[model samples]
Target: MPRDHSHDPGHHHGHAHSHGPATPHPAQPAPWSILRMTVTARLAAALAVSAGLWVVVLVAMR
Candidate 1:
């Protein structure tokens, strides 16, 4: 019968592994930062652009 080394702490699996939260690789883009615009600011800008588009459409329809 083969011995079970899977449960042995001293066993080596010849593979890399982690036991905690995975970290982002250095090549990946950083997460959002405080320096970026806030949700409210983004919403306001989107609304402004939408309003401008609506105005253009209304004028074009005339």
Candidate 2:
């Protein structure tokens, strides 16, 4: 008689088992959310300033 190895705890048959839909964490901003927002705002402001300067130079050159 051969022992069945499929049900062995140490065997991994590359099968996925879904517990259920993932549950969302508590409604709270991530620790880095503020830093991300600040960096985004700074980048946007820098781009806006750069565009304004380029427009000024172009208009002056014309």
Candidate 3:
């Protein structure tokens, strides 16, 4: 689709576009509930993978 480049002479090109919503700070840890849940999920996934690999090794040793 072609963008409309049509402009009115009344529209000033000198206008600045410096306005937007503020984002959350990266340094700040997320909410306790959210952070705790995320950590739990990651740890669970890690432990699951480790256990799976360990089982594979054990079965191979047999």
Candidate 4:
């Protein structure tokens, strides 16, 4: 007597299973824009502090 493998319940024959559609990823900001914004903010802060210190030195010398 020969045994049959086609009727096995635990057998998988290279069939693909689906898990629904994937969500879209969010858009990213441009690298140059981000870098320019950061540098501009830092430069503004540095200039403000330098001007403040120069004003203080001038007031002290009076």
Candidate 5:
């Protein structure tokens, strides 16, 4: 049986795409900061959220 993908862009009719990785890797390598906890994006986002909450609380008190 043959998979006819002549009308599609993602899937090929032949098994040509199998020569590459099953999925394309990210364009950019993961940063060293992301590999550590203290400098990770999640920690930065959390700190930003905590600072925003403090600002809201200060405004309410005023």
Candidate 6:
């Protein structure tokens, strides 16, 4: 019986085999620093809570 030569390792059909060494990416900044909320955010939160409290107080007083 004859052996098949279609699955030889010497043939690649013009495809890349080596990708070379991987380079390390630059360090990233702190995720908290990137998404840190400012004073305006706090003010908006306070205002929302104040408005909600005022509405509840008015409803209770009624």
Please, what is the TM-score per model? Answer: 0.44, 0.41, 0.41, 0.40, 0.38, 0.42
The residue-level lDDT of candidate 2 at 10 comes to 78
lDDT of 1 by residue, 7-49 (tens): 8977877966554337653454759654597989888888999
Give the winner by lDDT.
1
Best by TM-score, which number? 1
> Across residues 1-62, which tens digit of lDDT does each residue of candidate 3 receive?
97565575456568554543275434655565535567778799789999999999999999
Any runs in candidate 5 off by more than 4 Å, and if so which? 1-39
Candidate lDDT (C-alpha), each = 0.78, 0.76, 0.71, 0.75, 0.73, 0.74
TM-score of 5: 0.38
Q: Model 5 over residues 1-62: C-alpha lDDT tens digits?
A: 99876766676555565445677844666665544665567778789999999999999999
Q: How many clashes show up per model? A: 0, 0, 0, 0, 0, 0
> Could you tell me which residue pairs clash in candidate 5?
none
Q: Which stretches of candidate 2 lie over 4 Å from their true place?
A: 1-37
Query: Which residue pairs collide, candidate 6?
Result: none
On a 0 to 1 TM-score scale, where does candidate 3 land against the true structure?
A: 0.41
> lDDT of model 2 at residue 60?
100
Kindly list the per-residue Cα lDDT of model 4 for residues 31-59, writing each as its tens digit. 65535667778799789999999999999
With candidate 6 superimposed using the best TM-score fit, by how many Å does residue 31's alpha carbon deviate from the native? Answer: 11
Give the alpha carbon lDDT tens digit for every residue of 1-62 in model 2.
99999888678768654443375544666676535677778899789999999999999999
What is the C-alpha local distance difference test score of candidate 3?
A: 0.71
